[model samples]
Target: MRAVTWALALWLALLGGAAHGAGRGSAAEAQAMVGKAVLYLQQHGRQKALEEFNRPQGQFRDRDLYLAVFDLQGNGLAHLNPRLVGKATGDIRDADGKAIFQAQRALALEKGRGWVDYKWPNPQSGKVEQKSTWLEKSGDLIIMCGIYQ
Candidate 1:
């Protein structure tokens, strides 16, 4: 009975550890996908860039991916989500949205790349969601990508 109890506890602990590790790995992979996508956009320019963003390929489309391009002054230029192409995401003004935008700007200036995890407001649902943002700088433009993990 004592050996059986110990074995059961050990199995449960291993299972829990595996679950936690899996979650962390998934988040890291999502982050990498965002990085790759941003890099691709930086090298390709807008005309050829939209094609990469249009589809949910491999691990990218596994969750919701949002990409936006902005000028240095924080004005949104284009978005992967066609419906929001002309919208002003910077003026979103809400604390979370503003912070994410600011972080993206900072990253572009500092390392030529930036990333942060935050909760974003979903326009359609009006609900807040946990997401990760990746920013890359290419000449005069900044490309920002958000992945809902």
Candidate 2:
């Protein structure tokens, strides 16, 4: 009985640790994505870089993805998603939206990299979606990439 109890506790602890690790790994990946996009834009320029970024990777289409760029003053410059283009994403109001924007701002101001999870509203169904955002600062510009669920 004592052995079984100990085994169960150990298993639970391991599971919890794995879950935490996975979350950390995901945030790291998101940060990397931001860095890659920034580097691409810096090296390739806007049109060519976007073309390459949007190109289908494996099974994903660039149109089905979201990317945005902002100036240091938090004004949007461009967005890969036409719908979001020119919108002020920094003042986003949803709880998750706010969190994501805050993280981006902090990264832009301090680390030059940011990652956060948030909810995106669906256009057709008016439902909120879970999403992750990655941001990186390049000179006076901030580039953002987002993955939605």
Residue 25 in candidate 1, Cα distance off native in Å: 9.5
lDDT of 2 by residue, 1-149 (tens): 13643353345344542432432223334445567777778888877765665443511223224456777666666654454455666676664436456567776789876454567763333578655566777877777765443
Off by over 4 Å in 1: 1-25, 54-60, 77-80, 95-99, 122-126, 147-149
Residue-level lDDT tens digits of model 1 in 93-131: 344545666666777888986555567765434577655
lDDT (Cα, 0-100) at 133 in candidate 2: 61
Clashes of each: 0, 0
TM-score of 1: 0.57
Model 1 scores a C-alpha lDDT of 0.56
How accurate locally is residue 83 in candidate 2, as Cα lDDT from 0 to 100?
47
The lDDT values for all models are: 0.56, 0.56
Which residue pairs in candidate 2 collide? none
Candidate 2, position 98, lDDT: 62
